[model samples]
Target chain A: MIKELLTKERIIIPLTGKTKEEILREFVDHAKELKLIDDSEQVYNRILELENIGSSALEKGIALPHIRDNIIRNIFVLIGISKSGVDFDSIDGELSTIIFFIGAQRNDKKYLPLLSKISQMCSYGETRESLLNAHNVDEVMGVISNWET
Target chain B: MILKGEKRILIPIFSEKDMLYLIKNIEKIDTEGKEFILLRLIDEQMTKNVCQRLRRDPEEYLSSIIDSAWNNLYYFQEELTKKEIHSKVSLKTGNALNELIDFGKKTKIKVILFSRLLDSGFEGIFKEKLLKNLLISWEETIIII
Candidate 1:
């Protein structure tokens, strides 16, 4: 399911953004560049609203910033890897190097399952290390495929 | 005083059973003019113990637990939205009782809905003593379904 939504184009390696806000904006902009969503600002704002409620940054170096809005037509997963980790207020207080920004329509049934899958991937130490070590889109895709299999 | 337009309901979900029960009985609760906040709490000690027993990394285990919790709560959120109910999902990690109390105080919640069967899942996490303490900790209404 994740493989279908996340193409090589959606994965950004060594993301240039250095802060949480910058990384989020970068993901939204990349989504815009790929013509995945119609309004980047709207999606960005909704993500911020959810973050204000609670930080999406999980333990380790993973952050999953997500939103479900009416404007989104489908579920999109944008994976970003920041070599210079960003301070995303993670649960373990570690910098976030692997970020998954998810956006989905309010009624998209696959949204939760995709989130669950990503979380499952992050649960494994080898998978998390593999993702961080991935130097390109193909390598990241390889890590995801290996995990899913 | 919770004004007519300011009333909010807090439903703290401890497990999948709690979510299922709440979705099944959402309409019976008086949710009119009130915003619903679905809260899911991850017990830190429980996570640590599980990780230690399984020989898993605590950080990765916690990330997975948090997301799995979100998955359950969001499914409930979607059901509420289908019923045209406005709602939000919150995930927190800590002592369940303390988190509930702190969240209630921070949000000025007017009511908290808990499943009568919650104790079955967490080895009596919501036992009589804790429930009584929760009742005494706040003046708001607590409905155990």
Candidate 2:
């Protein structure tokens, strides 16, 4: 599921930031460039909405920035692994080093299980460590690919 | 393989251990053909054995906060698959059975699965609540898993 959704087409590299907002902005810019979203401002608004509702920051050092789409046909996934963890407002309040952003259509019911897959993969120590050390976009993709299979 | 589907269950689990069990079960099951019933067992409170008259039950103090949390969890509309498991925590207000019936109607859920994991702490508190509030129509599909 992640392999099909997460590829070079949706990935970005070397997103520099020391703050959560800066890092999120980088993600927003990439999403806008790829036409995955209408605009970066919409992206910001989405993030705000998610935060206002509930934090997607899960257990461990992972945060899944997620949103539902009514217009899109397929699920869109973005993989971002930060060497320096960023605060994601997680339930456990852990700084997030690994992030998986999910954008899916509301009618696409397959998204949850795939999300479960991603989190299960991340739960593995070897897989997570490899993701953290990933140096390039392809490397991150490769890491995810390895985890999924 | 990734559990690929559109609708996943929204279960607001109370015990982390139970959540792990459900997650593991999902892993064993092929989710390619089915959707999920996301469930949430309202945590944040204890179902103590101390019970009293209807008006003095713990539900009075708890109904609001629990309902609020359940709604908050409901706002998570993110889906990764086409078919998935979905369930939710019971309402924090009114009678438990009635709350369940009302939520079931609103969500259009056909089944309500329960467990004996919780202590019968408040004597027949949960039982009474279900008897009083349960919709007569729901009797056919209630699953005690």
Candidate 3:
């Protein structure tokens, strides 16, 4: 399921941003350029609202910043990797290097399962390290697609 | 990893003993400069025993028990907030172990703190099951007793 949504156009290697907000805006703008979403500012605001509720920074330098809004027609994904890492307000207090920006419908059934799959894929250190060093989208997808659980 | 600033603690509240244990241990932790979040999960399975023993409707029993649990949680939240710790509580239904894993994955959790019942009874059995599942599901995070 994750592999299907993740295409070459959706992946951003060596994301150019310094902070979490900047990274999110860059992802949204990138998605807009790909014609995946219509509005960038609206989506960015919604993501910030979700962050106000709670930070999406997972352990081991991974951040899944997502939003379920009426504007999102399908479960879309935008992947970003930063070797320098950005302060994403993670509970572990570590900088997040891999960022998964998810936009889904409000009542989408596939949202939670997709999140679960991604979380499991990122649980292993080897997979995360591979994702960090991955040069392209296919390499990133290879790491996630080949992972068990 | 390096959990130096904000700390997210997952607390699974099973019985009064678990609640008391958390309250007692909260003071001992060095929560001086770092922000703290107390993610409390009120297990629905623990209330199932009460429903079976009392012979009440499952829905009604769950609602009543959850209300009581919220009261206790709100009280704890108020007290913890006084100590500069943010408290967020959730009422979980179905398998307690699976629910904990789901909640842990959904949130950015750093540490999990649960109580071990000192006796070889239902509490001990329940804690063991939860601990086992937690160990299998959450390998990166820290677990505290």
Candidate 4:
């Protein structure tokens, strides 16, 4: 599961962006096509759905959006970084430049393990710091693959 | 454009059981593409007054998640029985609206089908205007239940 969930396909860091919603929308659309997700309305609703409930923002300009809707099989992750910052509706009222799209299947056990794994990845101070410093695709990919070595 | 030739269809399931139920009807659904996605929503018991009745028990919560997800995939073989649709499942957490939109955008999903939570809190607040902002401008399909 981690092999498929943490592949290079969904990792994007050092992403350039100017708008809050535009960059995120672009990130989401790209990830969906490869996976063949057909519930745009449901997907859209779930994002706004989470916002109304609470923002998924984390510390030091990071936000993990984990919505437990079985839109795609298994847990999906998309890593996006915006140097310019974004209005992420965060609880801290800070500009969110980095976002990770966390998708999970609640009915089964994948959500928790992946969430723990992702959460474990997030807890790494060095990982977050480099992911923030990554200047290009290779640099970003390096930060994404840091967990191994 | 990467999936320009991929076949797309939205399979929205309520609970974990809903997915197993759909397996019985997979043959009738159109599956003429290389990939078929089973978009299932983990409908939490959330009303206007969520009440926090389901207190956060980290271990138990995680256990339930694992149980459902494993079973869902184990039984989705029928989804592949229909030729052309390469079946796969995605799991999301929390409310349906945000979960669906995030899934749609991240997956570049062309369509969305969802069940409307007709609770009192959703009355005038959630309408088409809100949906416009929530949904990506890409081609989409909406099924309101």
Candidate 5:
């Protein structure tokens, strides 16, 4: 299910963002550029609102920032990897290096389950290490493909 | 002071059986104009330890557990919807007791419905201590079923 939303085009390696806001904006802009969403500003604002409520940053250098709204026509996941982690206020007080920005239609039944899948994927130390070691988009895809198998 | 408004209820589910038990006994609770939050907390430390002991990938081991939990929670959410109960599902990974307390406090949950089944074994001592601590730490009403 995650593989369907996360394609090679959606993966960004060595993201240049230094802060959480910058990282989120980078992902939102990329989604707009890829024609995945109509308005980058609206999407970015909505994501920030959710972040204010609670940081999406999880433990072990991973963050899954997501939103479900009427504006989203379908579920889309944009993956961003940063070698230099950003402080995203994670529960474990660790920087987030891998961010999975997810947008889903308000009524999409797969929203929560998709988040669950991503969380499960990031739970492995091996998965995080492999993703960090990935040199390009294909390497990232390779890691995900290996996980799917 | 009497508080009269929408009261939110928190149900912390640890496994499929806990969800099933809640679904079976959901009718016992008053569901009028109440919001329910179904939460599942995955223990990261415990999972990592298990993976190390068994020499298994944490992703593979956690995936199976999380998938089953998600399925059960989705089913329980549907059942609640059928009865006109508005609910949200939350899946988190952290210290189970700390996460539960933090979530409950952050959401301003007025009540918590706990399944007695979860308190039985699978870190029974830890859960036993957690229950005791919850009663002591939280001002919200806790119903152990």
Candidate 6:
């Protein structure tokens, strides 16, 4: 169910951002370009607000920043990989290398399950490494599909 | 950040059953002006433990756990809301003990509550160390399991 939303076009390989905001804006811009959102500014602000609720940073260099709004039609996901990692105040106090920017509509039923998928996928050290080494979108999708299967 | 002089209680939930049991126990409390937060830990690293030892699909294993935790949280939240009890639910991924301690200190928790389940006995040594570490970190907070 989650794999359908994580297409190659929705992915970013080797994201070029030093700060959390920059990385988030890059992803939000991608979603905008895809026409997934009506207003990028509103979606960006909403994502930041959700982030402010708590540091979405999990362990093992992964952070899933998710927000649900009525403005978006369906769930739009953007996966970004950063080798240098950014300090997003993760609980483990480690830099986050893989950032998942998830924007879901208020009525999306699969939202929670997608979050569950991200949580489960990021839990594996091997999966984290695989994501970091993924050179392209297909490789990233392959890594996720491996777990899904 | 924790507010100045705000008393809070921390409950770490593992499953819907665990949360239901905890809620049943908590129903006896006064809970007039106190705040409660239900925390569900989705430890991703723990999946490695399952994959290596149990030789199972870590994603499916963790997904079931996440689903159960959220479902239980939703049920408990509805019950609390009906009773007019102020509470919040939190979901995070990491070690349960470390996250508990971190959250307790950050929220200035006055007490930490847990629903005592049957002991595994196999992980006695690890559980002892975790308990000792948690107690040592939050010496002033009362721990009720």
Q: Write the per-residue lDDT of candidate 4 for residues A16-128, one digit (tens) a residue.
A: 65654565566667667766356655765666555433345544566666566677566677778878777765433567766777666657556656644554455467887
Scored by TM-score, the top model is 6
Please estimate how well model 2 matches the true structure, expressed as its whole-model Cα lDDT. 0.55
Question: In model 2, where do residues sit more than 4 Å from their true spots?
Answer: A71-73, B1-145
Per-residue CA lDDT of model 4 for B1-145, tens digit only, reads 1234435545555454455545554544344453445554543533222334455665556446545553454345323532333444445546656776666666666655433432234322443433565455435665443
State the iRMSD of every prediction, in order shown: 6.4, 12.4, 10.2, 13.0, 6.9, 6.2
Better of 3 and 5 by DockQ: 5
lDDT of candidate 5 over A49-124, digit per residue (tens) = 6665545776689988887888777889989999999997764567999999988897888887887778778878
On lDDT, the stronger of 1 and 6 is: 1
For candidate 3, the lDDT comes to 0.71
Alpha-carbon shift of residue A101 in model 5 (angstroms): 0.8
DockQ of each: 0.15, 0.04, 0.06, 0.02, 0.13, 0.15
lDDT of each: 0.78, 0.55, 0.71, 0.55, 0.79, 0.72
* C-alpha lDDT of residue B20 in model 3: 66
Give one digit per residue, the lDDT tens place, for model 2 in B9-53. Answer: 223233334344445444454445443444444422234222233
Order of all candidates by TM-score, from best down to worst?
Answer: 6, 5, 1, 3, 2, 4
**Is model 4 an incorrect, acceptable, medium or high docking prediction?**
incorrect
Q: Would you list the clashing residue pairs of candidate 1?
A: none
- TM-score of the A-chain for all models: 0.96, 0.87, 0.95, 0.79, 0.97, 0.95
Model 3 per-residue lDDT at B115: 56
TM-score of chain B of 2: 0.44
Q: Which stretches of candidate 3 lie over 4 Å from their true place?
A: B1-9, B13-124, B128-145
Determine the C-alpha RMSD for candidate 4 after optimal superposition of all C-alphas. 14.5
Candidate 3 residue-wise lDDT, B42-134, digit = tens: 456666785687788878776555545544554454456546564444445567777777766777565776655443676667677778777
Off by over 4 Å in 4: A1-4, A14-20, B1-145
Q: What is the TM-score of each candidate against the true structure?
A: 0.62, 0.52, 0.58, 0.46, 0.63, 0.66
User: Which model is ahead, 1 or 2, in terms of lDDT?
Assistant: 1
TM-scores for chain B, listed for all candidates = 0.82, 0.44, 0.77, 0.57, 0.82, 0.75
As a whole number from 0 to 100, the lDDT of residue B2 in candidate 4 is 28
Q: Candidate 6 chain B — worst ten consecutive residues by lDDT sum? A: B118-127
